[model samples]
Target: MATPYIRMNGAGNDFVVVNALETAFRPTQEQARTLGNKATGPGFDQIIGIEPSDGADAFMRVWNSDGGMVETCGNALRCVGWLLLQSTGRDAVTIDTLGGLTTARRAGPDQVTVDMGRPRLRWDEIPLAEEMQTYGIELQVGPIDDPVVHTPGAVSMGNPHVVFFTDRLDDGFVRGTGSLIEHHPLFPEGVNVGFAHVLAPDRIRLRVWERGAGLTKACGTGACAALVAATRRGLTGRRATVEVDGGELQIDWDQATDHVLMTGPVETEGTGTLSL
Candidate 1:
């Protein structure tokens, strides 16, 4: 039998979502790759499996195109929220994942706002091998003396990230160095790398090199993670506009709630059925 799936995009980062609330089939790593293959199969950056939640509203399993299981995926979660709203007729939905619980609410006709929760900032939480006094402390990478951009603020949004602040978005050194820092030995579990240029007190231009997905058009959790890092480092305010390659996202670090709220748009890029 063929399995039905929905193709969706949040801030331009695409995904394939499968509802397994009633089924027991869990796609293997190889199966996930086959489903994500653009040439011969359904193309997507990640594949999301939605199962019954133990305590929360639902449970999500995320897999990158390369067949690697990921702890969290912000863009995919927004897509899940859309699906949940359609299926349950509820404006608010809570999703449980390996990372933590994420709450989503309908913000507009086609937009969803998610509370991504607090970011983990300690070196141990980021799970880095060594301890750094502060997340903004500098680190060396490769043989490039006077390294391109150091002193990045590290945070974990269920996954690890390093946010490097720059004066200009078009700086020449980010691309090469981003890859280097992503695999650097300092981060034992590897990390998603972000290059951010603060355009204003409440706006930033950002680019990301994901841990397992490489350079994607946009990343929802990355934006939230970056905002947390920037605010902690005094580079920007609690609320800011993060501009990615595909589009923009409004991120607010609500102090009262102690959660990161990410508001963004999602698109339906048609649907397909896959036979495994």
Candidate 2:
């Protein structure tokens, strides 16, 4: 059958979304690899599926471009929230994900906000290979005499991430150093590597190499991870504007609730039906 699909992007992180709440539609990893390929595929960072949820408005299921199923994608949550809001005429909606339940609301005509939940800081939670300090684990790149980047702050925003604060944004540092650390031995489940340059206490220029998605224009969870990590290290405040390759996202780590809030925009690039 021809299943309807919505093509959406938050900032520049794109997705191919399908609704399976009323139908029995399961996405295979093979399809993800095909749909996420830029040269010969549909070209998306991830594939999102909306399914029936007993706990929330919908359950968000995602598969990375490398055909790996993952727990969270924050931008996708905002996109789904907006879709439900548009359909139900409600400003707020709760979404169930592999990560957990996330509450989202309309912030503006083109902007949406999602509470990403508190970050997981424990080594066991981030699922590091061994017990160590997550803030600065025993990991490094380059020569021992002078490493390119080291002592990153680790945190899990439903997914593992290691954030490196650099003095400047270098293409070599972001790509080269990020790639090596993604598969480092310290992270048992692998990790997303982030390169961030602090423009101010409330502003950062960031880039991420996702666990299975590779390099993306923007990663919502990655942005949240960056903010929480930076704040924990006293580098930034609880709130900041993260400028990714795609665009900017306003992030805040609420002190009272300890939940991270992400605000951004989602665009409907186009709509079509997919043959499955």
RMSD of 2: 1.3
Candidate 1, residues 144-213, lDDT tens digits: the string is 6666577888888898888888754553455667777878888888888888888888998898888777
TM-score of each: 0.93, 0.96
Residue pairs that clash (backbone atoms under 3 angstroms), model 1: none
Give me the runs in candidate 2 sitting further than 4 Å from their true place: none
How would you encode candidate 2's per-residue C-alpha lDDT over 1-276 as one tens digit per residue? 888889999989989998888986676888778767877567789888899999899999988998889998999998998899899999899999988999999999879999999899999999799999887778777799898777888999888999888864667667777778888888878899988888899999999988888888999999999998889888999999999999999999999999999999989988877665
